[model samples]
Target: MSTIARTPTDDATRADRTWTLDPDRALPADPAVRPIAREIYAETKALPLVSMHGHVPVEWFAEDRPFPNPADLIVVPDHYLVRMLVSQGVPNELLGVPAAPGSGVVAETDPRAIWRRFCAGWKHFRGTATRFWLETELVEIFGVTLRPAEDTADAIFDQVARAIADDAFRPRALLDRFDIEVLATTDPAWSTLEHHAALAADGYGDRVVPTFRPDPVVLLDSATWGQDVERLGEAAGEDVSSYRGYLAALRTQRLRFKAAGARATDHGHLATDTTPLTDAEAAGIYGAALAGTLGPGDADAFAGHMLFQMAAMSAEDGLVMQLHPGVLRDHDRGRHAVFGPDTGFDIPVVTEYTRALRPMLEAFGHHAGFRVVLFTVDEDAFSRELAPLAGVYPSVRLGAPWWFLDAPDAMRRFREAVTETAGFSNMSGFVDDTRAFCSIPARHDLARRVDAGYLARLVAEHRLDLDEALDTAVDLAYRLPLAAYATR
Candidate 1:
C-alpha cells in the first residue's frame, strides 16, 4: 500500500501570499496636487534616514553576523508578531517565546514550524501597520511579490533565509544599504554597553549609538529595582543607597553612556507628570524607594521629581531628553505574570500635558541647552496640548506619531492637527522607533509616502507652494530629527 503525504493546515495558509504595491496608490489624483506631491516625495525619499530611537540588537552591529532564520528575523524580535499571535489564542511557546520564570513550556525549536504558525495567522494583521510594513519589506527588500500565506510560507521563508545568508544582509551592511546615517538603541542604566564600545572601537561609531533608558533605576515598583540599583551603583562607583548618592550615580552612568557615543535619553513613564521637589522631599522618597516600601503616590512623586532632575541634567549636559508618556503598561496582569512585560499588553490612556508638564516646564522649559522631545499615543492632545506646548517652549519639540499612532491615517491626522498650531518647524520629524531592524526602510518609506500625500494636498489647497512643500517634506523625512537631537 502506498501512503500520500498530507500537508499541514498552516501550509495551506502560506500558499495564499498576494500583495498589492502601488507607489502611486495613495498619491493625490488632482493634477495640481499630484505634481506638488511628486516633487515633495522625490526630494525627501532620497535623503538619508535618521533613526534616533529604536531597539535593534547591538550584537547585530557588533558581531556583524548573518541572521539565523526568517522566523527569528521577523517573529522572535518583534512584539507586534508575538502579541498578535497571542491574541489569536496561539501560545507564545508555539511562537518560540522563552521559558517563563515559573511555567515550563517547550518553545518551538524548528523555524519552519514557527513560520507555518505565523503564516496561518497572517490574516489577523489585516488593516494594521504590521501588514503594510511586512508587505513593503517582502516587496522592497526580499523581492517577494506574493504575501506570506500558508502555501507560500516555506517558499517565502527560504527566499528570506537565502537573502539573510548573503554577506550583504549583515546588520552593518544593511545599515548602509538602508542609508541610515544614525541609529540609537535603547539600553538600561545598568548595562555595560560592551557591544556599543566594541562597535565604536571597530570604527562604526558614526552610525550606531546607545540611548540611556533609566526606567529600571527610576521605577521603584519594578521587580528587580533593588538589584538594578546596586548594578547602577557598581557601574558608577557611587553609593546609591542615599538620595544624593543615587543622583550622583545616575550622573556618572549618563556620562559613561555619553562617552560611549550616546546622543539622547529616553523616559517611559506612566504619565507626563513632572515636579520640582525640594531636596528633603526627594531624599525621603529616595529612602522609601531604596527600602522597597514606596507607596503609589510616592512613586509618582518621585518619578515626577526625577523628570525635572533629568531635564536639569540635560541642560547641564547635551543629551536630548525624550519623554514618552501615557501608556497603561502591563495592562494584563495575567499575561505579564506568564509572559513578562513588553509582550504587547500595553494600552493607551488619555494624557494631559498642560498640567502634567507644568512643574518641569516651570523649572527648565526655557533653557536653551535643554531639548525635550515629547511623544503621545493620545491623538486628541496633538492640536490641543502638545503642539501649543512645543510651539511656545524653546526647549520643547513634538516627536512624530509614535507606536500605535505611527500609521498612515494617524500620521495624516497628526500633520493636520499639529501643523496649523505648531507648524513644521516645531516638529522633530520622524523616528522609526522599532525593534524590527528589517522594517526600518519600510517604516520610513511609509512615512515618506504619507508625507508626500499630505504635501500634495496642501499644495492643491493652496496652503503651500511646490517649492515650500518639497523643502518641508525633506526636513520631515530627514534633517529635522537629526537637528533636533544632534546636541552631541
Candidate 2:
C-alpha cells in the first residue's frame, strides 16, 4: 500500500486552501499546553474506535463494493450534506435526492456536477464541526491538500475517484485502516438482517453487528405501525392483535436479534415519560393502538407503558436498553412533505425527565439485571435532572451528548457539567451517531482529542493525576462503551 503524498504549495496558496489537514495545523503551539495535550493525545490516539451506535448500512461490509464517486459516498446519504446544500439554495433533487410530488426539479446524476455544487457552497459549513471532520477525512484518508472549492472541485473529485478505485480504499479495507474493532448498525425491528447474516457467515462477525431498534412497534401512531406490528407477529410466531401476544412477539423478536449478534436495543421517542399502568388500562391502550384509534394522550400513555414493559423485558433478556429522547423529528411539515424524514429537519424540544420517568424508575431503577442508558437533546437537564438520576439509579446510565450536541463544544460542556455529579463511569462513553462512513475515524479522532484536552485541564488543576487521566482517556475512547453495550 503506497502512501499518497500532498503536492507542495506556496504559503499564499496554502492559506487559500480550506479543507486540508496539515500536521502542523493540529498542533497547539502554546509552550505549556502543547506538551500536556500531546502526551494525553499519544496515550489515547491509537486506541481502536468503539462504535456502539451508528447508522452505517451492513451491505457496505457484506458486498464490499468500491464506492462509485465522492458524491454518492458523501453527499446523497448524509443529512448534514443535504441540509447544508439546501441552506445555500441548492435544490435537494439536484444533489440526487428523490423527487417528491409538486416538485418538478430533477436530481443530478453526474458526480462532477454534484461535487461542483457542493464545493460552491463550502462556506456554509464554515466554523462547524462538519467542516472539521470533512477536512480531516480529505487530508488523512484521501490525501488531498487543496480545499474543496469551485476552483479545485474537479481536481479533488478526480483524485478521490481514482483513490476509491484502488483496492485498498474498499469499505472493508477502510474499516481495518480506521482501526475500528466493532461497529454496531441500528436496524428497525422489521428488518430482515440478511445483510448482517451474510457478513457474519462470510467471516466478518467479529467486526460488524446489529442493534435492535423497536420504535415502529412502540410508536404505534406512525403510518406503517400496523403493518410493522403484523410483520413482527409473523417474525415471532405470535398473534399481535392481543396485548399479551404483542409483548410476547416483541420479546421473541428481541431474542432473535440477540442470537443474530445484537447486544443493545435503541429507542427514539418524543420524550422519556414511562409508566407502569394496570393490566386493564395497558390492554385498553394496546387494543386502541392496534385498532388505529389511539388519540394523542392515549399515544403518549401507550409509549410510556411500553417503556416500562421494555425495561422489564430487558431485565429478563439482558439486552441493554438505550433511550434517546427529546427530538421533534421532521418539525417542518413542508420539508417532510417534500424530502421525507431524516432530511435534517429534526429539532430539539425541552424534555422533562424528573417527573416523566419517576413511575418507571420507582419500579425498576434498582433492578440489578436491567440497564437503561438515557440520552437527551435538552442540555439544561444534563446536570440538574439526568446526572442526579444516573447518580442514584442502579440501572440508569447517561448516554453521551448526541445529534445536535455531538460537536466539540457540546462534548466539552457535557464533561464539565456531568462529571462533578455522575462522574465518567456513569456515562456510556462516545458513539458517532452518523450515516457518513468516511467520517467515522475523523469523528472518533476529534472526540479523543477533545477528551484529552479536557483531561489535561483536570491534570493541570491537580484534580486528577496524569496516570489516572490516561486510564480514563482509554476507557472513554475504547472500553466504557463496549462494556456498557456488550451483552451481559
Which model scores highest in TM-score?
A: 1
The residue pairs that clash in candidate 2, if any, are: none
Candidate number with greatest lDDT: 1
lDDT of 2 by residue, 287-380 (tens): 8887767866888888888888888888888899999999999877776767666763788999999999898788888887788889988999
lDDT of 1 by residue, 293-344 (tens): 7866887788888888898898888899999999998888866777777863
User: What's the residue-level lDDT of 61 in candidate 2?
Assistant: 90
Q: Model 2: what TM-score?
A: 0.93
When summed lDDT is taken over every stretch of 10 residues in candidate 1, the lowest stretch is 1-10
Off by over 4 Å in 1: 1-20, 29-32
- CA lDDT, every model vs. true structure: 0.85, 0.83
